[model samples]
Target: MVQNPARRTALADAAIEVLAREGARGLTFRAVDVQAGVPKGTASNYFSNRDHLLDQTARYIHERLTPDPVMIAELLRAPRDRDLVKALVRDIFRRISEDRAGYVALLELRLEATRRPELRARLTEAVRDELDANVAYHLGQGLPGDRETVVVLYLAMTGLILEQLTLPEVLGTDGLTALIDAIVERIVPAA
Candidate 1:
């Protein structure tokens, strides 16, 4: 197996694009190599098997989706109020919107996971950990709202991102930012 971290990341990212564009059925080593502009079998060199490739792709998506610490720090400096929650939610939405491919690939992974118990378990654990980490971060940072609030926000944002990506028409233009504001204003307690 290849020992290059950069090469592995490239293959994983290419796999993400393949998944987003072609779904699980189309994610082959050759397809990843083509997408990554690498020689044939390059993906196979980095990943032992299809499941291994899928697992690494999932990890890469999570790594890309995590918020930047500098951005988080900048946002955290704001008042710990519902407004802060709104800002954070907005940032989350922005990140997802910017990385549409990664988010879409993640959705594909979710679908693929339904047919593979091992993948399902891994995704479940990863998502739960992310949720817990967000909750912990919120509490540790003195942010308004509790675990319930974060959970609700997570669900709401997930739905919003899904709709926005798959069918923007479902959420008319007027209801976009206004809707986010409403969610935070109602769920996040004013401090």
Candidate 2:
């Protein structure tokens, strides 16, 4: 079907909102229909099933969460300075803070991935691609290790994000900044 960009964007936003507010259990055609202000069966017409809806929602969240081109270019071009890394880390934390609901939806998707192998594979590949990109950028700055280091750091960042999401005040801006500083100090210390 030829979908209007505005309509598709609205439906996608509504899906994310529903998934965030209600988790996987709360996601339904009716709820999305209400959220999107579309008639019943509209969402189903676009997304044949709940799995399809969730998959698209996951993809949307991933795109929203992934680092942007400007940041990627900065990371690629900038020197291996500890301050630069810290700044990047702080920006990352800020973005996560701004999109708490999306992060929560992603967490729900991660759990669901475990039970569904196909979803799990997709999730794994997505994570791996992200890590590879970051690893390549860091390597460009003369960081050590190969794919393994990138994977480990990616996992570590995920853990940090989860902690921030669960305990935002505890991992407040200052605390998270300090944590990132420490990580940068360890990984890319000043000369």
Instruction: Judging by TM-score against the true structure, name the best candidate.
Output: 1
- lDDT, candidate 1, 81-150, per-residue tens: 8888888899999899899999999999999999999999999999999999999999988888899989
Q: TM-score for each prediction?
A: 0.97, 0.84
Give stretches of model 1 more than 4 Å off. Answer: none
Q: Assess each prediction's global lDDT (C-alpha) against the native.
A: 0.91, 0.76
Model 2 vs. true fold: TM: 0.84
Q: Number of backbone collisions per candidate, in order?
A: 0, 0
lDDT of 2: 0.76
Runs off by more than 4 Å, candidate 2: 71-78, 141-149, 169-173, 189-191
Clashing pairs in 2: none
